[model samples]
Target: MRPFKSVPKARRGDRVAVISPAFAAPAISPAIHEQALRRLSESTGLIPVEYPTTRQLGASAEARAADIEAAFADPGIRAVMATIGGDDQVTVIPHIDPSIIAANPKPFLGYSDNTNLHNLLWNLGVPSFYGGSTQIHLGAGPGVDDIHLRSLRAALLEGGSIELTQTSESEDFGIPWEDPRALTSFGNREATEAWEWAGPRKAVTARTWGGCIEVIDEIAMAGRMPPLADLEGVILLLESSEELPSALAVKRWLRSLGERGLLQAAAGVLVARPPVSELSAPVPSAGERAALRHEQRDAILGQMALYNPQAVVCVGVPFGHTRPQWIIPHGGSITLDGTSRTVIADYAG
Candidate 1:
């Protein structure tokens, strides 16, 4: 329940441990992984240090835990970054040594399944970031998304207030790592809509919590959530995965959080841009997709109102499973000003 502590920012020549605590797609896409490493070095001027399981496929939970411990234990490493996110990081949670991570308390960057780690760190009183996957952000095609890069650079090297800007263009269509042509480019993007804000026009600043809705649902089901007292005055950020769950499903998840008193406890909420279409789902016509997205957004707002009528809510801010993501600081100060309709975070110097 204690206020989470922020880790020092990364600097030039600093060492960063890159570990794959979730999926190991990097093993199959070595080309992209290497390119990402090169980009990290060139862009940040920091060395990307990979752990044993960073590129190892089918890496056991114990092995991943060990790498996590080593990353935080190593005094040389200033920050830790996940290569990408997967579905089963929850399995690695039990094996993680809280004291080891808590004692070191270095900034950890990731999203998706890495939500497990974010929650774990928050419970341990260490703040972590909710974005920055090496494959998605750093290795995003020939050039990284400007929004992604800007948010990440600020979170990594400096610490201060960061404004969340809706991107004019964004993508969610993921390419296959196995296909030779997949690396060429598979996703398409279009102009983004402005963020929607609702409730009393007042500004509220507080630390952040929450992550991929699917993953948090799992955490809640497993009864692994932190103390409710810890979440008070925190800003809640939620996003849907590429799976693009049904509008009903999203509503149910939010309702469950409300039932648990989480939604009511937070100061404000920022819902990321959800993926309306995915590779697995049959592509809906443009009109259908837009309608579906609006339905989902409405469902979320209704659920929040049902649980926490006074909660300040903002929808369609860029983050989560979409491209041009902003790296949100887990358990760090976020200022949501309803008067200005702005969602800003003091994430880096």
Candidate 2:
């Protein structure tokens, strides 16, 4: 495995590139996209520059790679953030110029299908954040979530050891950007549960890795992942999409990781709160959703016990498909202190 390098932090008024490495949801929802740009300026005082294919639908992998290249190669752009994630960023990998990204290392942020790019950057020895989509997190209805804003500011501008905290309240319900009513808030939040931990009380600090479970599965199946040895002693963080795979499917994926010898190599693991609702399905009753969440959590822990008995694990972290999502430093140092039951990100100073 290569040593990950820390990208310099973004300063106020610095230009940041927003690219759609995966799907270009921004094309369909110009209002939300515009809102996200405004939020970036209002919240961070940074100007967001959009790439050619950032809002183009059906952009080829080569086109996406070109946009990434353009963003990293441009000296004016201090950081790069994704508009949203989609399937098949894995296809973009082959066309990327590693030399360009390696030479001009900058903080790149996104989650979901952007996992492919995140993992690729990890292999290239550049650290990236695994959360904070402009459309999803920034343009979230009336305003951005406080937790998301806090973590993003810390990761982008203020460099230090940031302690991850679960929001006292959280939500995953989103408004449609097409409907004028989409701008109107449509969901209520519930109290957040404490993070669940397992394994002996030991301290292990290592560079973070992993992303959306479904995305990882796609990479693994396509044989595009880094070598098993490359994952050794790394902290693995994962979360599911709105698709909400059954508990049994979650177990199978973890079991496959164990079988591949990936799970046993990790020093620590963090699981994010999974999204239970999708565009096709209406939100379930509160009681039923809570019960389903518990079942999913247990399935993950059970598989971990069988595969990596000594690995430290935590669950229900507020960092995935849920609202108030946090931006995590991919391939950056994460201190998993089992005793205090806290996860801390040691971002570059």
Candidate 3:
């Protein structure tokens, strides 16, 4: 009924739990996982601790949930993060013990499939982060992107307004994580279009919500998302997954959000750049990639215009499945100034 509450900050040298609530990426790529651990410690001064199922392949939903419960229940665990995202985190949410998580609320950093967990926490009136997967961000090296690390640090350490900026360049795909060399350098990036802003010039500062649109759709369909009323004046932070869904698919997802009154309830909407291709797909030409993103952006804008014309919509924020992702606080405050073409997240660290 009221705003969500943030947990206490995780101090330097604090112990952070690394869990596999979805896919066991650590099992699939231990080398990359180990490098992520090093980054978590050497780069952030945090100790990374793994649970039994953290690296176990084919871990049961209950087993994964148990690990999550154990992470939140452990008073010594100052924070919890995912190894990487997979496709079935929605299955693991029903098994989470809300009481234990609510009782020991701590900073949670993850995105993509982990969106389900963030949505669960939002409904519990607890704030969780929307990015920072260890295997995805930390393991992609040439060092962490300054924007990503700045946002992560503010979310986990310092609590305050961190201005969001457009990444001058971004990667459409990456090398296989299984290859040890993948951890040595970040994915290749090329020049990118500047972030575009639209709608009212009037600035709106409100609690932020939403995540990987695909995950949001699944959990919403399962009747697991927060009440529609809870989103009053909320800033919607939406990004599609690495699945590189078709532009029409992206439209349908946003249309569903509009039909559910979630779009109308929002005061602002921030969309992540749509990934151009998947590792499995043939690499698209630069012009084709640009067109893909443009078409997706237009689809989103069209829906917003039809259903929630009053909402301030900003497109192409770098916080989804794309490289150089930034951390967004679920149910935390953010300022979307369409007139000024800027966004700022309140860490409340």
Q: Which candidate is the best by lDDT?
A: 2
lDDT of each: 0.86, 0.87, 0.86
Per-residue accuracy of model 2 over 50-114 as CA lDDT, tens digit each: 99999999999999999999999999999999998888898998899999999999999899999
Provide the global lDDT of candidate 2 against the true structure: 0.87
lDDT at 114, model 1: 94
Tell me how far the alpha carbon of residue 223 in candidate 1 is from the true structure, in angstroms, after superposition: 2.0
Which pairs clash in the backbone of model 1?
158-348, 158-349, 159-348, 159-349, 160-348, 160-349
TM-score of each: 0.96, 0.96, 0.97
Clashing residue pairs found in predicted model 3: 159-349
Superposed Cα deviation of residue 239, candidate 1 (Å): 0.5
Error of 3 at 329 (Å): 1.3
TM-score between model 3 and native: 0.97
Task: Rank candidates by lDDT, best first.
Answer: 2, 3, 1
Q: For candidate 3, give the lDDT of residue 330.
A: 84
Worst 10 residues of 1 by lDDT: 177-186
